[model samples]
Target: MPETNTARLVHRLATLRERLQPEMDRREFLRTLVTGGYALGMAQLLGVEDFLAADDGEVPIVTARVRENPDDPFSLVEQTRDVPAEWYAAVQNAFELNERLARIAYTGYLGSAVVPGDYASGTASISIGVSNEGQSAREMIRDVSEGISINTETIIEIEEIEDGFEYAEPRYVESVDDGRVPSGIACETPSSLATLSPALYHPDEEEAFFVTAEHAFKDEPDPVGHPLALPLDRVERLELGTVVYAHPGEDFVAVEPNGEMRPVSRIAAPSPVRVRGQYTRLGLADLVARGEELEKVGALTGHTTGRIQGVDAVTCFTDEFCRRGQIRWGGEMDLTDGDSGSVSYHSDPDGRDDDVLVAGFNNARTWWPGQSYVWGVSAYKLTAEHGYHF
Candidate 1:
């Protein structure tokens, strides 16, 4: 071979090596992510495509449910866990399909939820609820989702609830400490009583709010005009705040704190649970896959625990517009009329003693005879739609 030809070949090889170095580095980082069993989602942060390749290997996924900085609710530090590649692919596909179903939101579409299968099965499904007049809609859903598995149920008319459905009296705020009030207690609206939710924080405005069910003030001509008053045991009622934002689609209201006693990140229960953060959509699905249960403290029902039935759910049973990104758990017995605004929660898997993550707000429950479950807007949904976090 001549010298010029040899030099040209060497240059070509060098150029090829330069192009492949970044790819090699990315693969090495991914391998570390698998073996090390943790990641900060650097790929997503950097907008690096092909970070996760299709191979018969493990992959890292976010499993942590808290932020590194509690004050900055949006600063979600990704805590990841390694899982089989096949399982990740299956779950990811199911999630995508679920979102598609939600977007379609066809007529008579009562609701839907995602149910992830175990690791060994590497499968997932969507549970769809349809009204009696939804046969065509059901066929349409089947047409759009070809390979995904779906379970369908027909929602029928429900009879009126029994007249004498008795419940315990409302719980009032006995006292306040450090100028802060604990959640899970009762607060009085102009029209009705409701349970208080944990402190809701908005990242954009950097403001904290005391939240409750918007429907509690339905009878009032102007919900925002009336103050949200906290009834004390023996003392005069203390005005906590007034409605700053009313989200009827999600069925919750955010009250701007007006008095010294503001909402705290704690629940008033037998064993007090501290609010750390909230679960993502996939996080809730993972809990369902592992057969985990959610607990809640309502003013009337007190503390109760129940298994998660579904996640990323959509419900159109009662309202004019469909409510998306909901969670269905427990049974109707877990919630009552006064239990509205109570939040569903679960123990933080990666937190200190008594730390819990907010799942969603318990707004309403099923009344039909054949079906029985409590449903509400998930915490992830609230954050995704309105930028509020617990």
Candidate 2:
């Protein structure tokens, strides 16, 4: 080749590399924001140079979605996606505004969720749930903030609650089976039977726990340290673990395994699937925008799938204090009494077909007249508030 032609080619290659440098740096910055839980303080530290320099069409947002190494949580890899710039801005603003609204948590405020619009729409809105008695709260919500849209729904308590408990045979593990227990089977509490959830790991302690709904032991004289067992049949049961920590507000309990058997990162369904990681706030929003369905394996309901109703939700309906970072998905039929602790999940985009990322634990279902969906504390919320991962 001629010297002039070779020089031109080399120059073009260098120019291309220079153009991609900013984008690559931006990706890394966004990854830190997400993995760090997107705290406002952290954002201030990591200046938005690349974010601000980008054109108005689209921008890359790091998803809290991670690919977990089952044996090592520290080795988790963050994921990213290119989203419309307008949509990204709208969702980010909506999230911040949602947090502000939650802090206020005015009287009669039942709950709220941030809904992200589709890509083409590039919009976001907040759905605030208020009890009929919260007239002042409704007025505050209407004038809460400007720019971001707010939608309010009146939650009317029903006179008679529909029985959501369904009768089903309990699944038991054989005595000589593998030492690793998969989730979605029946585990007995001192007071009631509840569905098992995927393994939750604490990075700092490097410990894994067997998780279930805390309400399962609501009637216990002393809940903590209470033995949690697996029923072999109607008459026999095997000791699985003991409740180490119980967060009633989040409606989940972490059990310390007795070492006879450890919790595995898998779910028991028709075709067993492994738990890869979990969805982030934006990851769940992406699913909602794409109209994706969440699948779950519950003790009573068995395997079922349903649409995601809302993400980053705050619910004050059932408890004295409000629960933030809740996920509202599926419907009443997707969960039942014995189904509490079952996890809602979607196929992992970066993993094998049978691999799935958890959305959250299915702690309860709405029995109210107007709403009909299952709600639980999201995995992201748990990670942010407490250092737990799938």
Q: How high is the CA lDDT of each candidate model? A: 0.78, 0.81
lDDT of 2 by residue, 1-390 (tens): 557976975675445333332224456645654654445454433435435465545665656556556556567887767677668768877887899988987776788888888888888899888776776676677675668888888878643477856587766655528778889999999889999998898888888899999999989745789988888778987788898888887889899999997898889988999988888889999988888999999888899999988889998877678898999988888888889999999998888999888999999888887788999999998889888889
The segments of candidate 1 whose C-alpha lies over 4 angstroms from its true place after superposition are 1-56, 64-76, 158-164
Clashes of each: 0, 0
Tens digits of lDDT, candidate 1, 225-320 = 568888875346888988988888899999999968788889998888888888887777677777899999998888999988878888878867
The local distance difference test score of model 1 is 0.78
- TM per candidate comes to 0.82, 0.84
Model 2 clash pairs?
none
Clashing pairs in 1: none
Give candidate 2's error at residue 295 in angstroms: 0.9
Candidate of highest lDDT? 2
Most accurate candidate by TM-score: 2
